[model samples]
Target chain A: MSGLVVERATPLCQLQDAGRFGVRHLGVTQGGALDWVAMGWANWLLGNPLGAPVVEVALGGLRLVCQRDACLALAGADLQARLDDQPLAPWRHFAVRRGQVLDFIGPRLGARTYLAAPGGFLAPAVLGSCATVVREGLGGLAGGGRPLQAGDTLDWRGAAPVAREMPAALRPDLAAPARLDLVVGAQIGGFDSRSLFDAFNADWTLDTRGDRMGVRLQGPVLDYRGEGLVSEGIPPGAVQVPPDGQPFVLLNDRQTIGGYPRLGALTLLAQARLAQCVPGERLRLRARDADSAQREHRRYLERWRQV
Target chain B: MNPRIEVVAMDALMLRLFDRIEEDNLPWLLAARQRIVEAFGAALLDLVPSYTTLMLHYDVTRLDLAEARRRLAAALDGLRVPEDDGGARHTLPVWYDPRVGPELTRLAERGGLEPADVIRLHSERDYRVFALGFAPGFAFMGLVDPRLAAPRLDTPRQRVAAGSVGIAERQTAAYPLVSPGGWNLIGRTPARLFDRQRDGYSLLRPGDRVRFEAIDHATFLRLGGDDTPLAPTGRAAA
Candidate 1:
């Protein structure tokens, strides 16, 4: 019966989980946490399943008042969080007294933050996920694919776990210059050797035109020498080169089919890191073999399971 | 020939069956997809079938890239290409109202044909559902009579209403949701292409066959077609 009442909210706040799966064949995009790592950690801090529903607060500007004394977990971006006007850091579980106000003022470290309540937030599952996809009008508090707004109440029924703090070594290093690892795609060889060199060597800046759908990378113009390709299935993290040559990394909510030639797709960890990057953040690309990329992904999942 | 498997991402693999979309490729792609689903079972997170590629998404924790590739290869080897008897056929009733299709006259003019001829050409042939994308339940049906082939609008409309039928190049499809689109509008259908409340959210799936049937306005209303214009009425062209 414990809950938090939304006192203020921004359009960016929405409910998310690991994402909707097994439904992309129906032309429905996978909608979930942009930064899956952060969402998992937030849920882990509460002893909830990794895929439990949580509020994804992007660029902050959200305020909530505890309706009852309860425990919650915060992870991902710092977002300049404050508890009753006092600074509250992320990556740990904390308790709040009744009527205590939790305000996320703005971003400080990363672009997105995850807030998890005990047992996750109560939301109707549409297509086996509570992850809100506003484009499809599915999921969310009311289950109509709407973002959190003022005067809304978030209810959860599970009890909180023992307080815990994320190990310093395991905490994501958001301040470090991002170096994304990309697995070479089928079309990689079709790109001009010069453009391919620039794609890997040149520093790429994250463009301001980005959302849950994709993030455009501003860097060298990648000239694809391949002829026009028949439209085909596009996977998340696929770095597609448009006619203008700017590469955009598709994300959870990308269209299912596309015709653009892809340099490659980023590793899962790289995608998580990219999700936290703000506009204008500079990053470099590194080519990774398929074997190493798969091993690394497995290791990350194994660590989470062990934790 | 064996399908070429390419690692699309850490957890995704794209199996390119052919370079071009052809009727002969459907059976192989469909059989391969079925076999992979049966072989991997729950380990396969998602499988997306497009015109000529099948993207398999798996949980890296459950199956590594090498293991997934091996399993997929084994599955393909065991696949039995079923006869191409065609797929489920649905007769979709369409109301070819000129008021609903803002570009109907323009499209006919470009094709050097009358408006009625354009409608007849579109309705006479059965289209195959090649893939579903752009939006949920939006089936990309194909090979619209070449005579009806026309370029997309120079500028896309801000919003195309749900159920609006559209043609672009050699393809024809109906919009399942109100969204920005550049396809030339031709008619509107009443049948819901996508309904979340339904057992199957999408009415038409890949491999299905669909045919448009011309219907009078009264029949359109009888079949639950709302009189609402597919898009905002009287909107200036983009």
Candidate 2:
């Protein structure tokens, strides 16, 4: 197989696509790239479908050696990526010669990076997706939910297109403190007025103990005056307020169902932005209506339809 | 009764079908899920059926939230109660003993009954699979015999072996995979509740009816049950 070989990688590095869908009823989580916007752009640069399988590299420490000359795209989280000693900025496609090494040292801006090959690195789809969910032990290279490891070969079949660069204006600014748009619903009325006020007004810090399943937010102790709830299906980006008062945003790999009362779920773009946030990053939540958030998400997807 | 629709996100809407968890509500919820799935076609990303609600996650690129709600409401109007009686029926074999079931004696003592009474109470009636969650293949079956009802342990055990039958309050379930849990374990089952290679990936789903058949230790081993003694974890639960 003429492709790249993983020389070294952290457990965080895994193959991801759009996600596993239509199977939530089986208690299966939708696992995919946390920063789906970046994953889309990476595949877009390579002329692949927006949801083509791409490598989601978090907190760097991944190294690959090219076995043959090939072209690939990199997007999201600068991560201080380099090609055989040469610094490579993200949001563009680049070429690699045989025997050259691609190294991701560490995060410079965002916490996650996406790397896409021509037709997405070849991997058998498990549960209709190649997205890895380590908790469920499903999807990924070898179709066993394991992350990329040393000596593993990654091959793609599609022909490489010409090089392209994402417009600077379209790139997300990782430096800014993200203002996540929370579509308030669920048990919002159950929360006390004071806690609700503090929730939107005060800045929340991203807790260090965050993962693909969920991210804990430390800020105001949200008081839930509502009655206890029976377990129910949890949507992606659902901000659940446990008894502790601190809120946690459930992500793609979250449990299919939960009983905790939710303040609301983050808008699509806000979730993609939250995926790039590093621990201790200060952020604020802004309330948004469902219709407006829907329109904004449609507009974001429209970018791919245009040109 | 028509369910009240609540917008939970940009691409999601939760239909509140009932206020309490009861066997009577499952058919309507399952029927509603089927209707919405058919109504949305490719636009429906996922429809999750839980105890009292069906959460519909749609593709925003195809249909906006307002249109989704409108279409969902129309589809659910005068919904026909499914002719199929309470989904699929399954009979699982369980070995009720203190060897694999650490809480078997404790639960029996709490209920003022013998271990045999606890087993009989659990396996006597059919339970409804209300939902699947907490873990892959973990079917949340419910309505454990009120006499055998037990509370979840104050501290959850770090690992509950796969196929362990457990009870928490009125709900009862089997641990599909080895995972941390707080339920009162009463026995072990040989059946695999979840298999990725299986057609549905999960043996039980929402609306399905399940009955537990008490089995002997020798029968459990014959049915592929793991016999390696559960090492004493000094845990009060699981």
How many Å off is the CA of B138 in candidate 2?
1.0
List residue ranges in candidate 1 displaced over 4 A. Answer: B84-86, B230-238
Q: Give me candidate 2's TM-score against the actual structure.
A: 0.97
Error of 2 at A226 (Å): 1.7
Query: Candidate 1's residue-wise lDDT over B1-238, tens digit each?
Result: 4579988887889998888877567777778888899989989989999889899999887887789989988988856788764578999988887767877888789889999999999999989888899998989888888889988888788778788898989989999988888898888899999988899889998888899999999998898876676543335432
Tens-digit lDDT track for model 1 on A1-307?
A: 5489999998789999989888888899898999999998999888888889999999999999998989899999999999997888888888899989999999899899999988889998988898888888888998778999999999885865655667878899999999999998889888999999999999999999998889999988889988888988887799999999999999988998899999999988999999999999999999998789878877787767676
DockQ of each: 0.82, 0.82
**Which 10-residue span in candidate 1 chain A carries the lowest summed lDDT?**
A157-166
Model 1 TM-score relative to the real fold: 0.97
Pairs with backbone N, CA or C atoms under 3 Å apart (clashes), candidate 1: none
